[model samples]
Every structure is written in structure tokens, then in C-alpha cells.
Target: MNARPLPSLNILTGTEVQERLIQARALQAAFKKEWKRLVETIAKTETPFQSIGTHEYAEELAVREVEQETKAIEGKAQRLEEITNGSIASLKKDRQRVGFMRSKSSVLTVGSNLSKDAGLMASLGVWADDFEALWSVQKARAASEALQEQLDKTKEKFKQVGKKYREIKFKNQLLSANIKLVENQCKELEKYRAHETRCKSKTERLEKSKALL
Candidate 1:
């Protein structure tokens, strides 16, 4: 037998996730409104019947109406549950995608930096070779003021490049540190969201059980 194909998953961005969450919340609010209306109607109808206790057929019809309303409320609650679960799953997937993107970006940045550094080192090697040739010829005329001036200029150029490299390295370190901090914050937020979801699920289950009772 052929295996069934798994459903394709799309990775949402933070903004898309927020929009989806908002839509889900709106749907939940609408369902809750409908459920509440049904509950209130059932309660109002049953109250008058319980007070008089004389109309047998009316009480029977009221009970049937309440049962229908209860079923509808249950259906709404189930839909809301599905929406909540789906939203959470979407958010989790989004978080994973964001983390992957961040990691990929960091790798790319490091690779680019390494390539640039390698090119700079190669240029510096050429400069060193040139300096070596110049120095060998000039060392014999070390007392000459012109040779001293040329040596000083070469040394200054090397110092400037070294300073620039140090600055770039410092910036890379700072960027990496910021990335790590953001990752930690995201993890903490995810934990909090998961905990909130669990609590909400538990509360929903308790409410369902009470409704059944």
C-alpha cells in the first residue's frame, strides 16, 4: 500500500503569526458570545418553569431546548479549542523558523567576515613583501633622513590597518553577543507561552467537565 502524504507546513513570520493569532481570537470571541447567549436563554426559560412546576409538556420542551443549546455550546467550545491549539502550533513553528533564520544569518555574516579578513591578510602579505625589499635597500643608508621618513610612513599604514581589523573584530563580537541575548529572550518567551497554553487547556477541560455535570 502507498503511504499517505504528509501535509505541507508553511513557516510564518512574526507579523503573520500575530495576524493569525488575532483572527483566531476574534473567532473565539464570536463563539463565546454565541455560547453565552444560548446559556442565558436556557437559564431564563428553565427558571420560570421551575417556579410554577405545573406545565409538564412545557417543562419537557424546555429541557429539550436546553439540551440542544448545550450541544451547540459544546460544539462552539470544541471549535474554540481547535483554534487555540492551531494558533499555538503555528506560533511554535514560527519561533523555530525565526531561530533557524537567525542562525543562518550569523553563519553567513561570519563567513563574509572571514572572506574579507582573508583578502585583507593577502594584501598585507604583499605589503610586507614590498616593505622587506624597501627595507633591505634602505638599511644600508639608515643614516639618510629620506629612508627614515619612508619607514615611518610604512609603519603608520600597517598600524592603521591593524586598528581597523581590531575595530571589525570588536563589532563582530558585539553582534554575536546580541544574537545570543535575543535567542535567550525568545526561549524564555516560548516557555512562558507554553505554560500559558497548558493552563488554558486545563481550564477548558475543567469547564467542559462542569458543563457535562
Candidate 2:
């Protein structure tokens, strides 16, 4: 069997790569848990508002929609994790098979003289070729898996960053709205005080005019 070259796998930065993988897994799990929590929250929210009419129904529906979307995302993330884990297992099995075939080939070639036992040697060659083919396929699968895993991690990272940005943006908006409301209230109070002072001054002037008359 002609040995094929293994591709270089230097993309990973030692323990850092493992750390990222662990973090990704943890995040995936967290998302799943969060999804469940969201579902529960939605259910609880709905229960209280169920007796109300369409407005409350609409709010409940919106909550359910959000929960559904979250669940979908969590499912996809978990699926990606499963695919990566499966690929790792497949690669390990392939490696073992490759090693076994190499040993078998060495043992067979040592005793079989191609000149005297051409047919037998041909059979061994066929076996070696089969093993080589399987090994090549396994190698390709592993490479594909590695690329996919990297892509999944990148996508997941973006998802987390986006979520964080949205949360901060929402909080900022709420704060701004609250501040505006307070400012409006202050303005209204100031106007009321000014009107009250004018009324009091006009009343005092009328009293003085009546007393003089």
C-alpha cells in the first residue's frame, strides 16, 4: 500500500484549543438550561394572563415565540457538539485500523515472495489496498470534522457576543427612557408651581384692591 501523507494539524494552540472546546461545551449546556428556564418562565407568564383577552394572549404568544427560538438555537448547538464528538470517535477508530493494517501488511510481505507466489502476493496487495483506502477515507473524515468543529465554535462565539450586545443595548434604552420620563415629570411639576404662584399673587392683589375701594 502506498502510504498517503497526513495533513499537518498545527492550527490548535496546545491547551488553549482544549480550553476553548471546554468553554464551548459549557456554553452549549448553559444555553440548553437557559432555554428550559425561558420555557418555564413563558409558561408561568401565560398562566396568569390566560383569562385576559387578546392583548395578554399576544404577550404570551410573544414569550412563547422567544422560547421556541431559544430552544431551536440550543438544539442546533447541541447537534454541532454531537457531530464533533462523533468525528473524534470515528478518527480514533480509523487510526487504530490503520495501525492494524500496517502490522498485517508487514507480516504478510515478509513471508510472501512475489516471484514464486504472484497470486498470493496479489491477494495481499489487494488487502493492503483496501486498508489503505479505508485509512484514507478516515483521514479525510477527520479533516472534515476538524474544519466543521472550528466553524461551529466560531458561530457559537458570535452568538454569545450578539446576545451580550443586545442585553446591554436593551438596558441602556430602558435607562434612557426612565431618565426621560423623570425629566418630563420635573418639567410638569415646575409648570404647576409657577401657575400656583401666579394665582396666589393675583388673589392677593384683588384683596388689596377691594380693601382700598
Candidate 3:
């Protein structure tokens, strides 16, 4: 028998898995927002650098803030990804269990039908021939059932692996978006550094001119 579709199996337990995925996406968005906030904070702070004491101290503070924010985002993203993956695993296991139970049901059904047929044949005085034929049929049915059970198990395993792969895909998307934001932040930071340098130069030049006056 052909295996039941795995995607359809996901519907066996709906909404909960989708909710978990939604939450994961939310966390990813939060990470993006936090990163944006950090960059904005840096941009705002950069505008005030001329009077912010030593240049080293200002740069040090900016570096520390970025590091802290990035770490927080990474930690949150990691946890969210784990949660999503765990939910997917649970769904996969549940589907496999259901499939196994159905396989057992199929076996029981076949056995019940065979026994009923054998009893009818015996009552009709065809006992000798029916016994021989029924016994062989039972054996063949049992063997087929066992093989189908094994196939079901293998299909379940593949489904579990596929679910895990889907989770990985989600993580990759999040990482890609985060990386792009980081690159943009780096460019912004460079601009801040360059602007700070120009400010410092202007300040020093003005001081020198005042001394000569």
C-alpha cells in the first residue's frame, strides 16, 4: 500500500504547530527591531561625539553597546529556533505513532475477517480443504502485515528527517536576514566613525586658531 502523505499528517495536529512557528517568526522580528534600535542609538550618539570626552571612550561605549545587543539577539534567536524545531519533532512523532496504530488496526481487521470466513467454511462441511487454504491465507496475510508495518516505520523516520530539514530552512532564513542587517549596521557604524573623525579635526583646528588670536 502507498504511504499516506506526510503533509496531510501535519493536519492531524493543526494550529499548535502553526502557533509555535508564528512565535518563532515574532522572535526573529524582535531581533531585527533590536538591531535597528542599536543602530539608531549609535547614529544619535554619533551626532554628539564632539563634546563626549575622549574619542577612545566614545568608541568603546559604542562597541560595548553593539556587542551587548548582538549577543541578546543571538541568544533569543537561538532559543526561538530550538522551540520551533522541538514542536516540529513532536508533531512528527505523533504522526508516526498514529501510523503505527493504524497498521495494527489493519492487521486486526484482516485477522478478524479471515477467522470469520474460516468458521463459515467449516460449518459448510468443507473443513479439510478450507483449513488448508485458510491457514495459508492467514500466513500470507500476517507476513504482508508485518512488511507493511516495517514500511510504515521507515516512512515515519523519513518524515521526521524532513521536518527537521524544514526547521533548518527557517533558521537559515532568519540568519540571512540578520546578516544583512548586520552588514548595514557596519556601514552605518563606519559612517559614524568617519563623521566623528571630521568633528575632532574641526575642533582641534578651531582651538589652534583661537590660541593664535
| lDDT of candidate 1 over 96-185, digit per residue (tens) | 655665565556555567776775575566455545544543443333444345445444543453354355445545655654554555
For each candidate, the alpha-carbon lDDT, in order, equals: 0.50, 0.53, 0.50
Question: What local lDDT does model 3 show for residue 118?
Answer: 60
The ten-residue window of minimal lDDT in model 2 covers 47-56
TM-score of 3: 0.36
Full-model lDDT, candidate 1: 0.50
- Each model's RMSD to truth, in Å? 41.6, 27.0, 29.7
Candidate 3: C-alpha lDDT: 0.50
Cα lDDT tens digits, model 2, 18-137, are 555465555545554554454344347422212222321433454454445456556665665666566556656666665676676656645546543664565576566556655655
Give the clash count for each candidate: 0, 0, 0
Q: How would the candidate models be sorted by lDDT, starting from the highest?
A: 2, 3, 1
Q: Compared with the true structure, what per-residue lDDT tens digits does model 3 show for residues 21-76? A: 45656776665565445444434642221222322244445445444544554565
How much is the lDDT of residue 53 in candidate 2?
26
Clashing pairs in 1: none
Q: What is the TM-score of each predicted model, taking all chains together?
A: 0.33, 0.40, 0.36
Considering only N, C-alpha and C atoms within 3 Å, which residue pairs clash in candidate 3?
none
